[model samples]
Target chain A: MKDQKIVIIDYDAGNIQSVKYALERLGITPIVSKEEEVIRNADKVIFPGVGEAAWAMNSLRKNGLDLLIPQLTQPVLGICLGMQLMCESSEESNTKGLGIFPLEVKRFTNERKVPHMGWNQLEKLNGALFKGVVAMEFAYFVHSYYVPVSEDTLASCNYILDFSASLQKNNFYACQFHPEKSGAVGVQILKNFINL
Target chain B: MLSKRIIPCLDVKDGRTVKGVNFVDLRDAGDAVELAAYYAEQGADELVFLDITATHEKRKTLVELVQKVAKELNIPFTVGGGISTPEDVGVLLNAGADKVSINSSAVRNPNLISELASRFGSQCVVVAVDARFAAGKWEVYLNGGRLATGIDLFDWILEAERLGAGEILFTSMNHDGTKNGFANETLAKLSEMVNIPIIASGGAGNREHFADTFIEGKADAALAASVFHFKEIEIPSLKNYLKSKNIPVRI
Candidate 1:
């Protein structure tokens, strides 16, 4: 996987540099681009985001990526907002998602806090994403909305309630947390994704 | 459960760490990137660098430092001090900073908060407020607690949140250098009033102080300067103590 061609979607959702740096530290220099052909031909695809859904979706559609992403057959990993956009729909702006997964993204009820921001323990670990990661391992998460747990859920975390911490269906995998900033456990997760 | 964050703040001047750190193993303790990576390995959940660069050209030095640190460090970090406009914030974020904390600039012009939030989402905008108790109320201060403002702390924070501040970094001027403990009473009040996470800064002497702030004050995170710099309270031991006290923290 070290020699694999990795491409990160240059989706204008803010903070794509962190993903590039994270991968660089692992000895892989991923190509950051918005060109459809370059992304479609990569060995691995990294979808990274950090802002509003409606605005990001507009940016995706502008580059004609809204039609190209769901068709990606290679191993694809979506992070934070990237993960949310891969769902059926989101409540952030009532935006329709790519529908790779049937789960619907909903907002937190304010029973505790709006954005469940901080390090939270991962539970019920499953699939290749949790390959070397243990149960109750901490991962950095900063999101206001989440997808409900389903058969595709690889792991779950409790914040206000049980939510899908990570999801996988075929070659598509998504995580609500930021693995790029989650320390060693995060580094291992990235390694697992590349090795997949 | 969300783990309580333990952040070590570095006072940087001209893109270098100002306060003396007691790490004998460090070749250059003043190097901001080195100190940031050291803390990240010490189990610090996050790091906040307060740059006190006075000149305009020297601020670019901070961006370069942030880029180097971001390349090497794995955990999240926030950069602050003298950030006035969105252009300033955009440069820092583009350099790989997770968030930017604005205090005096945000106070002078409230719309800056809304503008930054709208431009970069509320998650990257942190409103840092410095205050001290005076005249039967907590009064907001400017210029590192040197000048006093007629504004009340509670009123200003609520307004900042209304204007779209993601998190509040409240530093109690009275307890900052005292080395006694955090202002738990006021912090608890802040948690009760706001729906967002509150970061308690200043007045941290020992490991117990961190525990007290998280339990009694109900803070989402506790930040300290001298204690961590001088090795008075090592982060690894502090996190162990916190765990023993039943406080959730990432080990």
Candidate 2:
């Protein structure tokens, strides 16, 4: 397992360092790269991000990384804005995403909260991410926009409404929460992603 | 639903955790990294490391300590004190701090808040307001509560929030070190005025103080120093108390 290569796609988004540190804590030195070949040849890839949707999308498009991302055959994991970028489109800046999942990222409304920041419980867990993790385990989240629960939703959390906490479709997996910031349970999720 | 947060704040000076009463009478508490890992294991939702070191050389040492602690724990950690610029914030964030807190510098240059938020995102920026009631008004203080700014407490918090501060750490100087309880009335008012999360800091002597801060003060989180530093209140037991009071706390 130590010999397996893990690449963290550097789209110049936020929280990339924390994700790298989290992986390092698990004894895997992940390569932070934007180069096409390095990302393409990795055993596993983590597409982690934080920040405004439009700015991030523009950066990805500028580097032509947007075109390269969808073509990766390896297991890819997206976090927060990275997950939103994987969708069909987002209300934030009205930008289009990778369309890996037929989902829409919308700004949270209905007067509940804007960012929906803090730790919240996950329910209806499915897929390899929650293989040994229990139902209703808490994970740290900080985001204003969220991907609504859809067919690709693997885990759901209710903030203003039931939203996708974790999403999965084929080899691509994503989480709206910052699992790197979450405690021990988060380590398990990262471990599962590595194993997958 | 988001659970209420219990944050254990460690005052780090010269690479060691220090306990100071009302920002005076400093005494060594323990090692920062060890104390932080203990708090994380004790059910502390998050940790705040206030680098009280005044010199540039010691500040660098604190940054090194942050890297060491970040490697030892998994919970979110916030670093504050002596962080004046976006580059300073960048240093700590790169050192593995989840957030950087600014107090005096943000007051001196209000634009710093927006600059940091734009560069690192608002989620990584925390604006701490150390306030004290004087002459029938709550006024802001700076330089570790040695000087008072004429800015109104509520007004400054609202302004900081508008300027892209993700959260506010409101410490009531009048209630600090008293152990009577948090300034619930003032905290509740501040909570009503701001849309972002407010962390109630300063006076937290027992478990009930935590509950009062959450239920009455309406704060999103409670931060304390002496109580936890002296072991008067264990984080796990305090969390259990909060849970029993029907307050949602991570355990």
- Evaluated with lDDT, which candidate comes out highest? 1
Score residue A7 of candidate 1 by CA lDDT.
98
Instruction: Give me candidate 1's interface root-mean-square deviation.
Output: 0.7
**How much lDDT does each candidate structure score?**
0.93, 0.88
lDDT of 2 by residue, B14-107 (tens): 8887765232222323677777877788888889989888898788898889889888878888999998888898888878888889999999
Q: How large a fraction of the reference contact set does each model reproduce?
A: 0.80, 0.49
Q: Show where candidate 1 strays beyond 4 Å.
A: none
Best by the TM-score measure: 1
lDDT of 1 by residue, A88-174 (tens): 999999999889999899999989966798899999999888899999999999999999999999999999999999999999999
DockQ of each: 0.86, 0.62
Off-target runs (Cα >4 Å) in candidate 2 are B20-29
lDDT of 1 by residue, B20-104 (tens): 6777889998988899888999999999999988888898889998999899989999999999999999999988999999999
